[model samples]
Target: MSQAPQTAQQPVILTGDRPTGPLHLGHFVGSLRSRVELQHTHRQHVLLADTQAMTDNAHDPDKVRRNVLEVALDYLAVGIDPALTTIAVQSHLPALAELTLLYLNFVTVARLERNPTIKEEIHARGFGRDIPAGFLCYPVAQAADITGFKAQVVPVGEDQAPLIEQTNEIVRRINRQVDAELLPEAQALIPEMGRLPGIDGKAKMSKSLGNSIPLSSTADEITHAVKQMYTDPNHLRASDPGTVEGNVVFTYLDVFDPRKEEVEALKDHYRRGGLGDMVVKRRLEEVLQNLLAPIRERRTQLAADPGYVFGILREGTRKSQDITQATLDEVRGALGTFSFDRS
Candidate 1:
């Protein structure tokens, strides 16, 4: 599903996690792994998108602030080097807010409502007719986040294509209006494992849904979550033939297990009967533990040094601010007479 634009040189990349909670395995498989790999080949900027998180969680500012460090730990634990990738806090970049305000003029409320990602998220949040204006306008802010860095590549799940498309539309509209290519049209780099289903067999893994296994979960927690994971409901006995298509356990194994042959064999055994749920659960538990153990260890070490983690974020924010200021200057200069200074 990954689609990188053809280019002679490496393109600047912008990607991020909403700092509302600790990142989960869904984040790991979807974007974090690719980001770690992409940093070596591209100019990367990873945002702790607190402002975007606040679009929905506006009532809990403290929760957002606390999770900023938690999300940063997850990034560093998973090998996202700040030296290679600028990891910036979204709220610190004031220029993004200004850019969002300006970009709002180019798009209409109807267009925002039609953004598939926003629409899906609003329904997921159960906002219905009471959707927050900030939540509705998040696409414009996202456009600012991408263009402020002049990012040409944005790694995201397939569901987020609408956001990238919306950003590019704004980029095209602004370019045509000003007779200048003021911003780059960022491309979406969708991962092969685009979305991970929840452990409860839900369509998507979400923190609010209480089905996600957090990246920072301990070995015991991992085991517990796996034990409760939903498998075929009709396969009630160990001797009963089981289905793997909709089984969350097999789904996770398919994504996380390196030994494809082993997983396939296990699937065959289960389908033929005699392979109990406990057997499959134990194997999955082992696979997940092996995958996450090192990450947890690294996260523990990084957590002990809070100053170093925050120091990385502070330095990154400064670097991002410089880039954003340059973009804002160009955007303001193009509009003529509107002055929004970073000072």
Candidate 2:
């Protein structure tokens, strides 16, 4: 409906994860690490997506709370500096919820069913007979998250392009419905390397599926996880030819290991029937250790200051609150919901 946001002078980026569990290597490789880089260049807003978490995990509030700190730690652990980015709780922002209510009127239930991400997640989570209403309306909430900040750049994995499409559709419909450009049309920033699949060779790394490698994993945990990492499943022995074409191990290398030549070398060796899974797994472990060491150390240091993480969230919430309230006022004014009891 609008021109794809090709470029902006330091465009605002809003992206984040649901605090369903501790963040894993999947998050770091897929998006968090990129957020750290973008914070310096783009106006960044990293949401602690608690409300989204509640959509599916509503029955398990404790699970959500436990992971709230876990997700924040992962954000800090992965170097998303709070000073550079706004990191706030999704539920804490009233404007987001307010906007979600307004946007829901514009989207049909059939349209939400057509949303690819929601469909995939429902099948994956297997919420067949009793899909929660909260879960059903999450895309409207997501539209709220994006437009509440008026973000222009939302980094999405290849699979999540539909979300941007859904968000922009809301933007267009809302502009037409309200006779105002109250919301901004956002573009998907798909990274050069898309989502990394699970170590178990599933489509994606996820907590429910139990394929993720946590950012806080011990060296031994990393070792075991790596040793068991799925390679060419049919390659039974060292002498048997292996395939790296769809192997998750090679997928990790393509995303994490910067030494492309070495990965290619290893791939060649495997296809030639001499490379053992252990050799490649060990190499992956080493690569991950180097990558995660600083994050772990920083997490340890930050853990010492529990108050600090909360302070960051509180401050970010306050700052986000101001802008969101103003936007809500305009939206409410358009809908004739703004009034004061000055009597």
Candidate 3:
């Protein structure tokens, strides 16, 4: 185990999305936008977490396999430059699985059950006592991912901050065992917009729920989704005053509309009276149409060239294998594990 030498190189950031389905506006607002900017300033590794997706989707391995390319397409469509960012598939990295198995020795089952993120997910999925071991131990796997890359920073939603905290805890435990800093502790970089609500006004925006707008939505799809956005139920008439606190339309406006002053003024009008739901919905529709047009176009073009997209993943994963193998060797040495020379 060793501390990384201090250098002027860009800080390394590890962030990723599960390949369960196509990414949506929730993904864009939460992390994708920040990733684009961070690439210029940080050594960014964008992982397509196909293995993590399998923790819950084990029954449908085909679904997990199919969406890896779908998620990668979303990344490329959203301006994630393969030249600036390393976009690798999670299952392709053998060292990560090895690291996960090794790191499990440092964490306990009781603690894993107590993880807030894990707890919430388990309950949400109605797993009860049937939770798969892989599902419960994903935090440990995440710790492996962060440390394998020696990532100094990780971009995630506010709800996921606890996972980063758990990762650091594993890092400290391993350092204490080895009497040296074997891995870097990762800090969570949460987006300012936090989590986006479902168009149906649910607290979570999920593709499975069918309430999220995919990044590749056409203009009509965008408009239709915005039309279904939840606003104040009490404000039935266009002239009636409305509440803005829990209105999903206003929430989307705050995030997507760049005209801050105008949105603020429109909010005031809606709160006082005279603003119709259609009027606000139209504004949101226009804003989203403009935002997603180029992204959808780019995705169509990129989707046409499947070979080019797979080549990017192949190259990135090859580069990642070298880095992770070095880290695994260091970890094995720190634990005094026996190794045979292949040569």
Candidate 4:
């Protein structure tokens, strides 16, 4: 007999990123680092969400296509071992598409519109009445992705917790429709460090806003980005007291710096007056360079052997295809769909 979804041995985790751009520092702090750690203890599946990226980037299909490999390289560079985790491309998995269609029947458009994550995204994209049907139904697709794999845990930012809630609602509806506990509901595992803000101190670090530092950024690029990070505009002189609450440099340092005592001392000094922004920025730069150096080198090495990376993806996707197909077969049978094989 197969194990339960939440079996203590190795629970399944489904988490992924949209292939609209390369991942950045925000991704690392928010979820990627946890993913690296979780792989050792969980059956993890990371999806390259290219199809979802197209909901908004429909006009620029090539951009999404190119970033699929870029995102894959970022994953490999960050120490996500393909041997321990399955890394599959969304478009390559046909079962996910079919499952999405079937799951749509269990959800309503009104509820999709009410999903907090979807609402925020729609407002951010400024898609008022012109929201794409696909974009509005993204939560359904995510439900398909989760239930198709019977994922018991999903790592996501706090803002995305509502989507997981909606996914569970769909799972419950499906169980009622079929009168069987055929699908597993997922729980969101939010990181201790929540969403990282943009360099400009915006609420989000987004590539489209040009306020993000890509994972593949060079030393010079890292330095330049750090220099431009938002600090207290009132702190004109080094001796002037600065606020740490909104200082982006100190925020990055808190997350990236290893010496907690040193960071706390610096924070106290900044609040007390005498520490310059550049002084703190330099420290942050050193910490970031140290953290990203090995990752960048690994990414460069992986990029050179595209064939090897592609092979990993192909093999992972093949494994995922079988798993999803089995789930689909079970779902279809429960829904009483006619299968030629059953004839």
- The most accurate candidate by TM-score is 4
- The regions of model 3 sitting more than 4 angstroms off are 1-8
In terms of lDDT, the poorest run of 10 residues in model 3 is 1-10
Tell me the TM-score of each prediction against the true structure: 0.93, 0.91, 0.95, 0.96
Please identify model 2 stretches exceeding 4 Å from their true place.
Answer: 1-9, 341-343
lDDT values for all models:
0.92, 0.85, 0.92, 0.91
Query: Lowest-scoring 10 consecutive residues by lDDT in candidate 4?
Result: 1-10
Q: Total clashing residue pairs per candidate? A: 0, 0, 0, 0
Model 3 pairs whose backbones collide? none
Rank the candidate models, highest TM-score first.
4, 3, 1, 2
In angstroms, give how far residue 117 of model 1 lies from its true place: 2.4
Segments of candidate 4 deviating more than 4 angstroms: 1-8
Candidate 1 residue lDDT tens string, 226-299: 99999999999999999999999999999999999999999999999999999999999999999999999999
Error (Å) of candidate 1 at residue 249 is: 1.6
lDDT of 4 by residue, 239-295 (tens): 999999989998888888999999999999999999999999999999999999999
Estimate the Cα RMSD of every predicted model relative to the unseen true structure: 3.4, 4.2, 3.8, 3.1
Question: What lDDT, from 0 to 1, does candidate 3 have?
Answer: 0.92
TM-score of candidate 3 on Cα atoms, chains taken together? 0.95
